[model samples]
Target: MAKDHYSVLGVQRTAKPDEIQRAYRKLARKYHPDVNREPDAADKFKEIGEAYNTLSDPETRARYDRFGSDYRHYASSGAGPGGNGGRWGPRAGARPGRGGYGNVEVDMGGDVDWEDLLGGWFRQQAGGPAQGTDHEAELWLTLEEAVRGGKRTVRLAQPDGATSNYVVDVPPGVLDGQRIRLAGQGGPGREGGPQGDLLLTMRIQPDSRYRLKGRDIYVDLPVTPSEAALGAKIKTQAPAGTVTITVPSSSSSGRRLRLRGQGMPNPRGLPGNLYAEIKIMVPPSLSKEERKLYEKIGSVSDFNPREER
Candidate 1:
């Protein structure tokens, strides 16, 4: 058997409409699954919704008072509330999945009214807009996206069994772990409150070619043995674009050449620097001509690469 509407709402059988509303709001705020961690909170909130929806309507309340939940079924199904006919469900707000109060926090969007004054002054609900707990989600960005500052779309699966695609603007110089807010996109609120904002924590995806620290970026600058030893101007990829860098004469692998203001653009202050670390690469397979050239250099030059400085 369904619980009595009055008992479910913790209200007197003679409770006034406002009183019932206040009580329902209070319970909804207390038991809403978005804010409350209790296993049965969703069920409790749903029960409160059912009670409020039934008792708030004059016709339903009168019919319920005269008969019972059995009569409620008949009334909802086009029959009078006095007879037991068909079992029926409550209105939208009563069902957790049906009305959308499970995973969203809603603030009373417009101006305060009698409901607000009554809810606040009586402490039936908090003084501020009735809201649910804050929620968090992860947002992954590429190094290019983070440095360049642009927009990206992300798919989010919410707690109340809802999935959505949200577009977010990525600000220039956004750092990892930074949070972006999408207003009114979080858990549902009690009654007619506005939804809470969804917070996204930015994460820069790992790239083999680039390593980022704060605003600075590091990248590998590959050069041949001939180029490193004799010095040359070679082009390499940077956060912003490709740039030519001059290698010092007799340069070795692991040497870093700095590029100012080329790492990441700063929206408020000085931009980060880019470092191009030199890596000497050798050909995996050498032809007869290359091997003959290497043998010629080895035979002529007495340079010992392993000798300590």
Candidate 2:
């Protein structure tokens, strides 16, 4: 079934722009693929991302409300979400062999002077030679690498037979989808103009064990029913390492435990907190002795959990 974008974000169709953004942020923090691993999480995240990308822009939002599913075709045709042809797919007249998504060539305007645009304005005034075109490339990184800061060596595949690797040092606290730049790494200088920069669009790898929400990290921590009932300090593993966590006595399942400074760091250089959500494990079968003990305890305990409900 096609999902209603408003319903997916838990917002009414009449929701204001800010309201829609807030709803998306709230739900995205919950179901983002990096944080959620349920079978439907990735689909849900993509849906949410698509919805946000469309509704966040005024022109696209207007067209979406007017056209609904049919709007997608229009949106992909370089209408509605203008300049997003790469995200939606190739442009209307893209060549069969042409690539997009940073490879799409745009004709700025007939008035645009190629030689002037390529070189500094001085060269343009003097009618200098056509400048070298800017080269584009992509770089992928892991979530942990983006968070903890690490060094990466990327092998650049140039058109020529020669291949070279560039060592890149990623700073701590980098967010997903953030771009980095390398000066003078683009096409060589043309007509005495300096070479353009190399732009790196980052794509963070998916994590299996951790989910990042803004600056917070959430992990499901399994606990035995007894552990939930009569709390104990048990050792648990964190992304960094193993650490002992104390489950408060009489705690219930789904209780969240906060570990300060255990999450991804922020731009301010302070690490975010980690949240452990408790899930009580109940064995399907019980031993004879266990059953007998439970029966005896039930006979004396008068714990009718359903009485109130």
Candidate 3:
């Protein structure tokens, strides 16, 4: 008995064209002989191709819907939906003795070209070896790692309960959501064709010290109350390293000091800038000398912060 084409493709009889195509692609990728070494994989792949070929075409699908598995026989014999001797006949302009059913021409004696029938990737596969499908994965990295590009080892979990490790070369200044393509590292090709690429999307891990917005880097610059009142040179940590920046005199909290080109580096264009946001800090408890000095300053100075506000 012939197998149901819709069942073979794992789709409903009423499945849409795009749905059928998607199912075919997924099953073909899973059971392709080059990818799946199981004994039944090749047979399964061929069955999927045949099902797709029969159902992908609108005319063929209509006939299949009407005639089920025997659609081919009915198509070639000019039989109606009922049986072999049903009342369906050739169309008005169909050539006689051509085995025509409606407008479709049935080829009686030629070898079927599954490649042409299947189309898309199968067409390429029929010509020769077929390139494998590309694969995508997320690769999480620290902000420091993104800033300093280098080789790092990554482990990917496979479908068969195993893991594959790869040493990936990360590019400098790689931003969050950026994809890096590793050539010939994706799904294996069929019949010795070239392998596809493995695309790794960069996911920068959250850091307490640094926050990123586009190419710009923002870091909190903590300053003492004295430093904010009477400008001072402070050493703060940056992605590159520790750097000394002089705070402007009378600098207040929430002030932003921009460091040009000290942010994320851009290989193609201008590098991003780093913004240092000032955050004032004070001692939890003041010493006796500090209290005396504060009392004296309170008596001498007329700086009322509330009045200014």
CA-lDDT, candidates in order: 0.71, 0.65, 0.74
> Of the candidates shown, which would achieve the greatest TM-score relative to the real structure?
3
Model 2, span 22-83: residue lDDT tens: 77667655665545678877677678766765675544565567668667665323332333
Worst 10 residues of 1 by lDDT: 83-92
> Over the stretch 63-168, how does candidate 1's per-residue lDDT look in tens digits?
5775687654443322333423222233223337544234343343333343333324322212234564345566788888888888888775343424578889
Tens digits of lDDT, candidate 3, 136-192: 567889888988789988776443324578889998899999999989987667568
Cα deviation of 115, candidate 1, in Å: 13
lDDT score, candidate 1: 0.71
Best first by TM-score, ranked:
3, 1, 2
- Show where candidate 2 strays beyond 4 Å: 1-136, 159-162
Using all chains and alpha carbons, the TM-scores for the candidates as numbered come to 0.59, 0.54, 0.63
The per-candidate count of clashes, in order, stands at 12, 1, 0
Per-residue lDDT value at 16 in model 3: 91
